[model samples]
Target: MKPTLLAVAHGTRSAAGQRQIRDLVAAVARRRPELDVRLSYVDVQQPRIGDVVPAVRDAVVVPLLLSAGYHVRVDIANAVEGTGIPVTGTLGPDEVLLRSLTRNLPAADAVVLAAAGSSDPAWRESTHEMASKLQAHVAYASGSAPKVADVVADLRRRGARRIAIAAYLLADGLFYRTLHRAGADSVTPPLCLDPTVAGLVLRRYESALLTTAAGRL
Candidate 1:
């Protein structure tokens, strides 16, 4: 039997955010109907990682997070420890994500790649790397330096006539909403329900399964 694909996400209170996540998972399920795809959360919602992991006997935990921060390294790791259910890497710092961002990005003289920031340096570095790839400035909605609003203001001061914000988020939520008020001329929607996103999830799952099988051999 194929191992259950446990797609875990950072939950949100926004109804639209919730729907986007569900739709992303559903897209994955549709692509691979034989695989049992399940959805759960890391925070702010029901059937959290801790509760969901224990119930699945044979499964792989695929984090829906964009970066490897506390949630991926600490929260999800703690939940799946000793379960032998390997967890895949976060879904960012990849070409797939870059493609998703650019596809929806608005035209502008300057663009700020906005993310729901993290205290972890690794997470910050990953966001920066993605920003660099897009030739865009890096800004955080929370947690760390150079906030979205501040970046927008700075860009405007520096003579960027039309500034846009490329939201490096998984779904529409509090952070995405905040980007609008960041003083940018435009803000791209969050990354979810995109076919590339679903494809990336499957790639992570396949990569982890291969690694697990190789370890046994």
Candidate 2:
């Protein structure tokens, strides 16, 4: 039997943001109808990872986050520690995300990839790498320096009249509202609604499955 797939995320209070997360998980279910799928959050919501992981006998935890951070390294690790479950890597820095970004990128003289900043250098580095892949500037939505508004202003001063924002967010909420007000001419929607994102989740789950199988063998 395939292990249960627990789709974990950093929950939000915004109703729309909640719906986006649920819809994304629904999409994942559509991809593999036979798989038992579940949802939980690491923070700001109910059914927290600690509460959910212990209830499952065998499962693969796939983080819905796009980058690595304290949530991935500490919170999640602790949740599955004594449970002997395999936690898949966060869903990011992958070609699937790159495709979603490229397709959503608007026509502009310059583009800034706006991510939720992290204190972890590795987390920040992942966003920088994505920026490099898109040949775009990097800025933070919050929690770090070089805010999106500042990046947009710098682009304008540098003769970039048409600046776009590629919102590197998984769902809409406080961050998307802030990003839209960052003075960019255009801001693409969050990655949660992208069709490719669902596929990426499945790929991550499958990879974890393979790893689990290999360990058993």
Candidate 3:
């Protein structure tokens, strides 16, 4: 029997956000019906990772998160501890996500890559690297550095008109809504329901399975 592919995400209060995640999970299931794909959350929703991990006999936990921050390092690590189940890295800082971001982006004089920020320096750096690749200024909805609104205001001060915000989020929620009020002319949608994202989830699952197999040999 194949091990379960447990996709875990940071939960949101937004009903739309919840639906988007469910839809993304459905997309993954459609792509590979043979695999047992399940969904759980880390916060603000039911079926938290801690509760879900114990129920699965054998599985690989793939974080549906963009960066390796507090949730990935602490929350998930604590849940799967001593379970002998492998865990994959976060989904972003990858070319597949970059394509998704670029494809959704609209034309503007200035672009701000707005992310759900974290206190972890590594997370901040990883997000910065992605923003650098897109050639977009970096801002956060919360946690580290200059905020989304501040970046927009700064750009306006610098004579940039029609500034755009490229949402570096996996699903829409309060964070995405905040981007709309960030004083930008446009804000791209979150990276939800993108077929490429489904592909990336599969890749993470396969990669973890291979690594675990090699370790046993």
Writing each residue's lDDT as its tens digit, candidate 3 over 1-217 gives 7569999999999999999999999999998898889999889998999998988977999999999988988899999999988999899899998988888888888899999988898899899999999999999998667999999999999999889888999998999899999999988887986778999999999999899889999
What is the Cα-based TM-score of model 2?
A: 0.97
- The TM-score, computed over Cα atoms with residue i paired to residue i, of candidate 1 is 0.97
Scored against the true structure, residue 7 in model 1 reaches a CA lDDT of: 96
Write down the lDDT of every candidate, Cα atoms only.
0.91, 0.92, 0.91
If scored against the real structure, what TM-score would every candidate get? 0.97, 0.97, 0.97
Off by over 4 Å in 2: none
- Per model, state how many residue pairs clash: 0, 0, 0
Query: Which stretches of model 3 miss by more than 4 angstroms?
Result: none
Q: In candidate 3, residue 64 scores what lDDT?
A: 96
Q: How close is candidate 3 to the true structure, as a TM-score?
A: 0.97
